[model samples]
Target: MSAPFQDKVCLITGAGSGIGRATAVKMASLGASLSLCDINYDNLSATAKQCASTPRHLDDVDVGSKQEVEKFIKDTIGKLGGIEFVFNCAGVNPTSIPLEETSDEYWDRLMNANLRGVFNITRGVIPHLKRGASIVNVSSISGIRGSAQQAVYCTTKFGLIGFSKCMALELGPKGIRTNVVAPGYIDTPTNAGIVKGGEAVTRMINGNALGRLGTPEEVADVVAFLFGEESRYMNGAVLEIDGGIKMSSTTSSGK
Candidate 1:
C-alpha cells in the first residue's frame, strides 16, 4: 500500500522539541515532505536531521510576527510547492503568576507567542492551502477548563477555539478543515520546567485517570490521525488527548 502522506507537504511550527518534534518525525515516516520552523535553531536542526530521508526544510522564524510567518510560509511554498497540512504547535506555556501580580508586559508576551502566533501563521497560510487541507492547532487542556495562575494562557486557548471555529466555518466552504488538539499534561520540556517533580508532579499524575503523565508520541499519534483522510469528515473539532483527566473529577477530587 502507498504511504498516507506521500507527495503531501506538511508545515509544523515549534518543530524543535517535544510534541512538535514527535509529529515531524511521525509525519515524515508516513512519507510526507516536511517544512519545519522554530525559534530554537538547535532543536529545529535535530528534528530535520531525523527526517533526513524525506524532502525537508528548516527555518528559524518567530510565529508571533506576521511578517516572519508570511515569509516562512511563502518560502515553504516556493520550495515545496504547496502546503497541505499545518500543525500550529508554536506556543509557550504560561508563567505561574497570580492574577494580581500579572503585568501587561507578561500577558502581552504570552499572548503574542500563543494566540497571536496561531492567528499569524494560520491566516498567512490560508491563501496557499490546498482544498481538503487540514489545520491542527495544539491547545492545552487548560484551554477548556482553565488553570490556576494561567489566566492569560487560558484566554489565548479559549480564543483559539473561537478562531478555529471561525476558520472551520469560513474555510469549510473551500474544503479546508480546521481543528484544535487539546492535550493534557504530557512529558515535554515545556511542562518539565513547571512540573518536574515533587508535589506538583505527584498532584498532576494523581489527577489523571491513568495516574501518569502522557508522552509526546502519544499526542502526536492523534495529531497524525487528525491529518489523515481517516478524519476527513472531521472539522472544527477540538479533540482531547488527555489520560481521561477531564473525564472524571474523582481522580483529582479524592472523592
Candidate 2:
C-alpha cells in the first residue's frame, strides 16, 4: 500500500520540540515533505536533519507576527508547489499563578503565543491551502474545563477551539477541513522539570481514567489521522485525546 501522505507538503509550527516535533517526524515518515518552523533555530535545524526526506527547509519564525507568518506561508508555497497539511502547534504555558497574581505580561505572552500565533499562521495559509487540505490546531483539555491556576492558558486554548470550529464551517464547502486536537497533560521536555513528582502530578494522573499522563506521540497520532483521508468526514470537531480525563466524574465537592 502507498504511504498516506506521499508528495504532500506539510507546514508545522513549533516544530522544535514536544507535539510539534513529533508530528513533523511522523508526517515525514509517512512520505510527506516538510516545512518546519520555530523560534529556536538550533532545535528546528535538529528536526530538519532527522527527517527522512532530503531538501527539507527549516525557518525560524515568530508565529505571533502576521508578517512573518504570511512570508513563511508564501515561501513554502513557492518552494513546495502547495500546502496540504498545517499543524498549528505553537503554544506556551507559564508557571502556575493565581488569577489575581497573573501579570499583564503573562496574559499577553500566553494569548500572543497560543491564540494569536495560530490565527496569524492559519490566516496566512488559508488562501494557499490546496483543495481537500486539512488544518489541525493543538488545543488542551484545560480548554474544555477549568483548572486551578490555569486561567490564562485555558483562555487561549478555548479561543483556539472556537476559531477552529468557525474556520471549519467557512472552509468546509471550499474543500478545506479544520479541526482541533485537545490533549491532556502530555509528557514533554518543556514540562519535564515542572511536572516532577508531586501532589499535582498524582492528582492529574488519578483524574484520568487511564491513570497516566499522555505521550506527545499519542497526540501526534491523532494529528496524523486528521491529516489523512480516513478522517475526511471529521470537520469542526474538537477531538479530545486526554485518556478520558474530561469525562471523569470526581468532584471537589464532597457528596
Candidate 3:
C-alpha cells in the first residue's frame, strides 16, 4: 500500500521542537503534505530542513494569539488546501515552585500557551477541516494526577482534557475525531536540564514502568496513529504515553 499519509494535509503547531518536530518528520516520511508553525523561526526552519522533499508551508506563529493563528490557518488553507490532521503540540512547561511562589506572570504564561493556544488553533481550523479529519492534543500525565509545585500547569492540562472531550462530542456528528495524549517525563529540549541531573533522572526512571524517560518520537508515533485510519473508531480518547508512570507509586517531584 502507499504510505498512510500520502497526499494528506497535516497541520502541526509547535513544530520547532520536541514532539511536534518529531511528528512533522514522521508524517513527512509517510508522504504527508504539511503546514508547520512555531514561535521560533530558526528552530522551525531547522525542522523544515529535516523534512525536505515533502510539500510544506512554514510560518512563525504564536498559537496563543488568536490573530496569529487565524492568519496562519488562512495561509495554510490557501497554500496546502484543506487540513486533514491537526497536532496541537504547542505549550509551555512549568517551573518548580510552591503555589504561593507561582507568579501571576507564570500562571498567565502557561495558561496562554497550554490551554488558550489549543483553543485558538482548534477553533480556527474547525471551519477548514476536511470530513474525517483527526486532531490529537498533547497534554501531560500531570493533567490526570496532582503534582507538587505545578498547580497552574496541572490546571491548564486538566482543563485541556475537558475541552478536548467536549469538542469530540460537539464535532462527532461532523465526522471529526478529537483525542488527547498525556505523556510523562519526556526527553525533550524543555526537559534537557532535568534529565541531565542524576537525582532527577533517577526519580523519573523510578516512577516509570519502562524505567526510563519517554522520547518525543514515541509520543509522535501515537499522535500519528490517532490521525491514521487505524484509529478510525477512537474519539474523545485520552491515551497515556507515559511509560506507565500513572500506574506506579513513585512520581517525579517536578524538580
Each candidate: RMSD: 3.3, 3.9, 2.1
Per-residue accuracy of model 2 over 15-96 as CA lDDT, tens digit each? 9988888988888888898998999999888888779454466789999899888888888988888888999998885466
TM-score of 3: 0.95
Clash totals, every prediction: 0, 0, 0
Candidate 2 Cα misplacement greater than 4 A, ranges: 52-54, 192-197, 246-255
lDDT of 1 by residue, 1-255 (tens): 467999999999999999999999999999999999999999999889899899987899999898999899989999999999999998887667789999999998879988899999988999898788999998777778866777887888888888998999999999999988988877777783334467766766776788887888988889999999999999999998778784433111100
Q: What does the lDDT come to for candidate 3?
A: 0.87
**Across residues 1-255, which tens digit of lDDT does each residue of candidate 3 receive?**
368998899999999999999999989988899999999999999999999899999999989999999999999999988899999998887766799878999999989999999999999999988678999998888789877777898899999999999999999899999999998877787763364578766777777778887888988889999999999999999998877774544343221
TM-score for all predictions?
0.94, 0.92, 0.95
lDDT of 2: 0.82
Best by TM-score: 3
Q: Report residue 130 deviation for candidate 1 (angstroms).
A: 1.9
Candidate lDDT values, in order: 0.84, 0.82, 0.87
Which segments of candidate 1 are over 4 A away from where they belong? 192-196, 246-255
